[model samples]
Target: MEKQSIEQLQKICTQLRRDVLRMVHAVQSGHPGAPLGCAEFFVSLYFDILRHDPNFNMDGKDEDLFFLSNGHLSAGWYSVLARSGYFPVEELKTFRKINSRLQGHPATEEGLPGIRVASGSLGQGLSVALGAAQAKKLNGDDKLVYILLGDGELQEGQVWEAAMYAAHYGVDNLIATIDYNGQQIDGPTEKVMDLKNLKAKWEAFGWEVNEIKDGNNLEAVLEGLKKAKSLSGKGKPVMNLLYTEMGYGVDFMVGTHKWHGSPPSDEQLADALGQLEETLGDY
Candidate 1:
């Protein structure tokens, strides 16, 4: 594949970040921090990196997969999926509403085309991705699996179990990214539960690790994702310690643990939107 220009992808990342904030503010509920923090990486993967159709049918036959472990951040995922044409952009308005496909957490059980598993509880996605990776190999398929987790989710024992299993069995087709934004629902991850030496921990687990200087910077994320792609198929699973601001772009939301899972008030929403451009047009 030809390399994508970082400048162009930066514009797209800006739009995706706008979409994430708009969706969350519209619903008056959901997690914005992870989405805001990881927007560039999501844009890098969906628009500029991953190989898959937006109209993906989760048969696990030929498509690459994205698993969202921090399911509360579904607003951003849904926005990106819609903007990327996975489903109609109109669906974004239904987020977190009863009977809406765009639920508070992603679930394939609802026949959502792009999502492969339900992941609101956290920490299970990497294990699920590992299973899919092994299955893909068994089927002679070379498609890759990508999973994103919050830094807090790493505290789950299941994540380490999946980590051990992937390294032991050589699940080289999987790329796991941790949203190292520091803040969680209660407070900063350090205050809530210290995950000291996070990168070193992944390296110790036998995974190849890379760090993105700024997760919110589209150029940097695109470059890091390209590097991650190059490292694929090298007989080691990859983990990225994505360093990002907890709530990026909007000044009121950035660097705060309070916005992790809370909704913006009507006044706050207006204030937040005042700081962003409605690049792709709001849903």
Candidate 2:
């Protein structure tokens, strides 16, 4: 695929945001907050940053690989995958439906074109991404590995273990990003379980850390990803602490955890579609 201009990427993000709202509202199931919040990141990665092949190969021999640790955000990932040609865009309508490849959480059993492994268990994607990164090294493939984790997921002990392992082994070819939206299924992360000073925490674990203060902004996300890639292959894994709203692009849903897994009502969906432009047309 040809490199898209920043303007083009922003338009894709708008379209993707629309896709997420419709996909979730269609089934009245699936998570929406994180997906809407991470739309810019997903669009930037797939359409601009990643050197990926949508043809879908398990080995991923010479192409960049991405893993979604916080798999509840599958709606946005699936939309991006389809829009990027991993599968038919029309298949997005079947999200979370029986026998659909687009499960609530990404799975490999159905052989989804863009999914390499089942996710959504949280605190486990980093471990999987680390293994893939190391395998690439063993196979003499220098392509980078990327993973996205929710900020709330950092509370899990397994995440810390993988963090330590990656840093200890110098998994520098990997770039891990935390969607620091600060809201979880229960409530605000601070009210639930505060993740104090995340930048300091990741740096303390021996990884290169950077922050994108406004992760919802397309330009900021693109720049942050570029910086993260530059830090790769330098003997330490890179971490991007991306700050975004849980329910961005939707006025009523923003800043709240209520929409984490809640699909919008018919009226609510109409309002959301009003907020997001129908760029590139709906899937």
Candidate 3:
């Protein structure tokens, strides 16, 4: 894909938000909150940071690799992948439907052009992304590996184990970002399990840490990503704590955990759609 201006990237982000809302509403199923929350991050990664091939290589021999740890937010990843030219935008209509390649969570059995592994089980993506980074090093690929994880998902012990491995082994080419929306499917993440001092925890684990105060803002996300890239190859992994509202664009859903996995009703969908402009003309 060609390089896009910041204005163009923002436009694509709007379209992606629209796509997430509609896809979840169409199926009356699928998680929408994190996807809506991380729209700008997805837009930033695909359009600006990632050095990937839209042509779809399973091995990704010489390209930057991305892993979606919080796979419930597959809607945003799917929309971005489509918009980034991995697959036809029209394929989004098949999301969550029987026999559709776009499953509720990303899977590889169906041979989706852009997906490399199945995900949805939390606390596994970071390890997988680290493994990919190791493979790249083994092959002398000289590229980065990126992963997206959720704050709530961090309650799983496996996440910390992966953190230890990354730091211990000096996985310098790996970058991970967390969607710190403070909300999860059941309720607030704090109520579920407190992750206080998240930044300090990562720092203690021997990784570089950065923060994005407004993940919904395109400029902020781009700036954070650029900084993360600069921090790479320094003998330590990097993490970006991206603070975001659970449902950013929609008024009623913002900052609440209720929208975490709930599909909006027809009336509610209309209301949400009103908040976003039809940028890129929608998928």
Candidate 4:
């Protein structure tokens, strides 16, 4: 695959961030921090990196598949899926509303185009992603499986169990990224549950780990993802410790957990939107 120009992908990230903020503000509910912080990574995957079909194939034969382990950030994932043509971008308006396929978290019952699993319970996404990766290998498919996780979610024992299993089974086709923003709902993850020496921990679990210094920066995120891809099939599962600000792009929201599940009020929304310039045009 050819290297994608960073400038073009940056433009896409800007629009995705806008979609995230708008979706949350619309319902006055949902998570904005993770989505905002993770804007570049999502844009990089959908537009510049992943070999996926937005035409929406559930089985996803011979194509890369992604799962949102930290599903509360559905705002970001839904927007990217829609803008990428998995569904109509306008449907983003239904976010968090009753009877909308775009629920508070990614779900399967509604048969949402991009969601393969109903996530957001956290600590279980890696296991599901690994299952898909193993299935791909068994079916003689070389495609990869990707899952995004939250740092705070890692506190769950299931996450570690899945981590150990992936390494034990040599799930080399799987790439799991942690949203290491340091903040969860209550406060800083360290204060909540410190994951000291995270890289060493993953390495100890027998997985190859890659670190992205500035996950919010498009270039760093793209490079880290490409490196992880290159390291695939090398004999171990890959983990990306992607460090990002809790609330990125939005000035007031950045670096705090306050916005984790809090949507902005009318006045705050106006201020937030002003900071995030329209890139691909609002939905």
| Candidates sorted by lDDT, best first | 2, 3, 4, 1
Give the TM-score of each candidate: 0.95, 0.99, 0.98, 0.98
Candidate 3, which segments miss by more than 4 Å at Cα?
Answer: none
Q: State the displacement of the C-alpha of residue 103, model 2, in Å, after optimal TM-score superposition.
A: 0.8
Off by over 4 Å in 2: none
Q: Which ten residues in a row have the lowest lDDT in candidate 1?
A: 1-10
Model 2 agreement with the true structure over 1-283: per-residue lDDT tens digits:
8999988998998899999999999999989999999999999999989999999999899999999999999999999999999999999999999989898899999999989999989899999999999999999999999999999999999999999999999999999999999999999999899899898999999999979889999999999999999999999999999999988999999989999999999999999999988999887
- Rank the models by TM-score, top first: 2, 3, 4, 1
Compared with the true structure, what per-residue lDDT tens digits does model 1 show for residues 1-283?
2445776666656676677776777777788877888888787888877888876777667777888888988888887788788899888888878898888899887777689889898789999889989999999998898889989998899999999898899889998889889988899989999999988898899999989878888878878877887788998999988899988988988998988988787788778778777666777
**What C-alpha lDDT, on a 0 to 100 scale, does residue 243 get in candidate 1?**
93
Indicate whether candidate 1 or candidate 2 has the larger TM-score. Answer: 2
Model 4: per-residue Cα lDDT at residue 153: 96
Error of 3 at 92 (Å): 0.3
Q: Any runs in candidate 1 off by more than 4 Å, and if so which? A: 1-8
lDDT by residue (tens digit), candidate 3, 1-283: 5789999998898899999999999999988888999999999999989999999999999899999999999999999999999999999999999999999899998888889889999889999999999999999999999999999999999999999999999999999999999998789988888899999999999999989889999999999999999999999999999999989988998999999999999999999999999988766
The number of clashing residue pairs in each candidate reads: 0, 0, 0, 0
Better of 2 and 4 by lDDT: 2
**What C-alpha lDDT does candidate 3 achieve relative to the native structure?**
0.93
